[model samples]
Every structure is written in structure tokens, then in C-alpha cells.
Target: MATTEAGIAPRPDQAGLTPLLEVEDLRVEFRTRDGVAKAVNGVSYTLHEGETLAVLGESGSGKSVTAQAIMGILDTPPGFVTGGSVRFRGQDLLALPDDERRAYRGRSIAMIFQDALSALNPVFPVGWQIAEMYRVHEGMSKKDAKNRAIELMEQVHIPAARERAGDYPHQFSGGMRQRIMIAMAIALDPDVLIADEPTTALDVTVQAQIMQLLADLQRERNMGLILITHDLGVVADVADKIEVMYSGRIMEQAPVHDIYASPAHPYTKGLLESIPRVDLKGQELSAIKGLPPNLTNIPAGCEFRPRCPYARDICKEQRPALAEVVPGRFSACHFAQEVLDGDIEPAQQ
Candidate 1:
């Protein structure tokens, strides 16, 4: 693993690097005909150099939306980042102008989109897409950038990358396409890499390969990797920390081991129980009951109360603040301590 010392955002003109990236009270909403849907609500987390923060949640739980907001890619017509602070090395990216933010995006921070095939243009050769980043950012010659692209492809373990550099996105396999996305993400050596479901749509073997590739890359560059996915199995080995989200709010945050050992939130516990376990190989997998709250008309207090197993009147009366239940462990559950103390378990299935 690379050094974990305080990091500064890298700059061509500046000296010093700090791996600190903090998102404070991030709130995002979408204005639809139905009503304003809150996608992310007061979400906050800190990422550092060489750290892997796995964001776990079900679909529409705001995992991808949060990443979109950080990457400055949210659609403005309907999607709005109402309030937030995306700070990198002490600079809030939300405060920067469009030009500066654009510069920082691909240079200082890059994202590997979930859908690789769609992310790459159908007409352009994959290598050209990867090399375009260099042409735009580094102003490299086409031939030189193409060479760099091949090297990146090979770095991600794509075979015969020099020969396949001219291949289109559709030409490669699903796993290879994802590797291409990873190549482009790491092409600029960004300080942080937000991989939103990189392993989505892949078979089990391919998923392992992609996860290993990401782990290797993060170790190589000491990059802060924010892995957004619902796959608990992948997060177990690759992530240093885990942040569990539900109803657009962070339900729990802790080291990966701690999360697996003793979850402090009922939602998190249910998720853990849902994962197929080795010891109980044949047992049925549990599922969280009830659906996530509708963002536009979220319940009075805790959004998860409708689905939570241990919910009580107190839960209905007041919203639970994300509080620290133990050193380095945070949970938004009002009974976080009770859950951690083995006082509660998700009512089975």
C-alpha cells in the first residue's frame, strides 16, 4: 500500500500533495412533474490516499447520484445539487467556475462510468477515446497518445493492446470494455477514482478480474477509490472502509471488517444477512422487507422506519442523526448502540 500521509491535490504548478477529499452535507434533488425527489440528503464522507471507500446500497439509493454530483456531471435541467461541499486538498470544487471545474475533473478526479459500452462512443475506436483525454489534457501527439493508450490497455491486462488499439467498443468483450474504461480513468493519474458499478453486467469470473484490476491500480497509484455498488462480496476484500446508504442518507460507516462483524444499523445488518454466507451455504438468503421510501413523500422521521425491523414510536417521531456509536464507526440509527450490542437483528426475511 502507498503512503497514507496527508495529501495535497496534485498540480502542474504547485508542490505538495494531500489525499484528503471530503464531502460535507451533500444534498441533491430532481425536479419532476410529480414532485421534488431527494436523491442525496446530507451525505458526508472523507476519503484519503490509498484508501478504498465502498458505497453499498440498493438501486436508486443515491449511490450513483452522489458520484455524479462529485464528478460535476449531474444534468442541470432537472437534476440539481442543492447544497454540498466537494473539497479536495482544502479546495471546494463546487465553488469553482465551469472551466476550472472541468480542468480538475479529468485531471484531478476521474470516473469510470458503469456502462462502458455506452460511455464510449460507438463510432470512435476505443484507443482514440482513451487518447482523446491526453490530446485534450496533455496536448500529446496523436501517435504518442495512441501509444500511451495501448500501454494503459496493457496495464489493465487487456491482451495485445497494441494490436487491438484500433478496436471499437463493441469489438471487445464486456470485461475488456470495462478495462478500457479503467484505462481512461487512470490515464491522467487522478487523485481520486469513482468507479460506479464497474463490474455491473459481468459474470462472476469477470467481476473478480475487474475488482482485482481496480485493487492493483489503487495500490499502484495510492489512489482514493470510491467504489459504488451493492455487491458486498466485492467490497469485503477490496475496500478499506464501507459506507452503507439507504433512502439517500448514510445509514452506517465503518471499517470493512467492523461492518461485517457487527453492523450498527438495522438496514446494514439486513444487508449483511442477505449476502450468501459460506457457513450457511444452503440456507435461504434474507431480504429487507418493504420498499425504500418515495423521495418526494418520505415518512415523518426515519426514512427506513417503514422497512426497519426494530423501529419504534421514537423512530417515527424524530429523524435520527448520524452519530458515532464507536471510535471510527458512525450510524444514523437511533438505536445504534443497541444494534451493536447484539440487541437487534433484522426480522428474518
Candidate 2:
């Protein structure tokens, strides 16, 4: 496994190379009866081989929508990729034809969704579903596919893989179903793995186990991983970098330690403070007040201005671009330095 002096793995940017996945000025919109919902607005990021980038945000923060756009699975008509390019290894995924994109989807890029129960077909046997992945990608015979499926099941630590392979989705518990999803995702050993809240509905113990599995797999294959999650605690352990998003925009992007130790944006700080910690015994958790702005009618200035405690006249009147306030750390706040200097703590009460 790759480790730094801090005992953490090296991030993509730290390794010095072009990114495996580059999203530039990505924009997505949904035409609703109410209005145009700007789900992803000029968002940009890069994922390099062997790096884990966590997109952190609350519900409706456009985290999942961004992933769907990269996967080329966004439902059209209501949804559209309005602008920007999702470049993977110098190829624009958006510009690719349907057949070309399909070939890349599983063979080069894979996703493990939040709900395995819904993602997995109820009627199909879990083994058949896993075997189909190999058959489709490699054109293996039925016997070979079945054997590969058993091996994958065993690799994921599914109990009695041969016996459980024929069981229906309902027969497996929630954690087991998620393991099956992981098996299918890695069956082709894709270069990029987009995991959308992979630990949802799992207990703390199972959650850790799943995370460890992903970490181990990433090291083994040196693949880029985009982990979309709302839980700060989850990302704290796995992500090399963290991007805090609010109202479809990144509030802050920094190395994991920089984010936890000195968040430059108020929104990022609020999120870090909100997470319950063992160190702060008997202290009330600090929660960010107010709700995220409606995407259809976001605030004129900063999208987070309405809920931001340090909102100034400028903050209320003009939007702040995601600017690098310090080397290797970006923040979309005018007073990013002040926030990092501890001059802007959570407003009392």
C-alpha cells in the first residue's frame, strides 16, 4: 500500500501526473414543471489513478447528479448535459457515441450505487448477475463465467460463495447485497470506480468493513475512486482529498488534513464542526443553520450566502469564484483567510 510520512496514501496531484478523470466546467440541468433545476453548475475536478476523491455534501447538493453525468446514465428529456466535458484519459465521455460509451462504462469505468437492494434485480440470482458482468465484458462461456462469479463472491468474503451464488437478492442481508454490488463493480477491474454512498443502510461495523475493502482494492488495482458521501466521518478515514459542496457548488476543496485541521470556507468549517467527535465530550454538536437554497431559484450572490454566518455586503451582492487562497487549497469564500485564522467561529447559539 502507498503511504506518506503521515502514514496516509499519496494523492493524485502529489504524485505528479495528468489526471485519469478530468471534469471541466461541467454543467447539468433538469427541466421541471416548476423551472430549470441547475443540478451541477460549472463544477470541475480531477481524479488520478490510485487516488480517492470524496465529494461531500448534504442531500440535493448535486453530488449524485455529477456522478450520473460522468457515468453517462443521466435520464434525458428532463435532464441534459448543458455544457462542459467529462474527459477520461484524453477522451470526452460526453462526445462519445452511445455504443462507445457503453463499452467504457463497465470495462473502464464502474459504479457501486447507494442502494444495492434496488440496484440488483430481485428476481435474478445474485450469482447470475455477477456472472453476467464477466460474460458481457469478456465473452466467457457459461461454465467459465460461473467459475469467475464464484471466485469474485469468495474474494468479497461472501460466506459459502458456491452455496450462496444461486440465492436470490432477497436471500442476502443488506451488507451481503452491497458486497455483491462491489463484486460486480470490480469484475472488470475498471480504471475508475464511482461509489455513490456505498455505505448507506449499513451498520457501523459493516460500514468500516466495506470501506476497508474499497481501500484494499484501490491499492491493489491503482484505480481512481470518486466516493460521494454526506458523512464526514466516512470520508475522514478513506478520502485523500475532500470537496465540500453546497447548492451545487464546491465551497472548499483541500487535502483531507487541511480540511479537517483548517477549513478555509465557513461552510466547510460548519460541516466539520457538525460532525460529532469523541474529543468534544458533553458539547452540543454545531449544526449549520438554515436550508440549502432552492436550485431553481438560488441566491443572486453566493449560493450559501443565505445560510452563511459571516455573510458580508459583498457576499450578498457578488458570487465568489472557487479561488486558491493557499497553495493546494481552494475556497469559494471572500474571507477564506479570515475563516481559517479562527476569526470566524460558528456564530454563538
Please name the candidate that would achieve the greatest lDDT relative to the true structure.
Answer: 2
State the lDDT of candidate 1 residue by residue for 122-223, as single tens digits: 999999999999998999999999999989998999999988999899999999999999999999999899999889789999998999899889877878
Model 2 ranges with Cα > 4 A deviation: 1-8, 14-16, 278-283, 344-349
Clashes of 1: 5
What residue runs in model 1 are displaced by over 4 Å at the alpha carbon?
Answer: 1-19, 278-284, 344-349
Q: Score every model by TM-score.
A: 0.93, 0.94
- TM-score of model 1 (CA atoms): 0.93
In candidate 2 the C-alpha lDDT for residue 1 amounts to 28
By TM-score, how accurate is candidate 2?
Answer: 0.94
Candidate 2 has an lDDT of 0.89
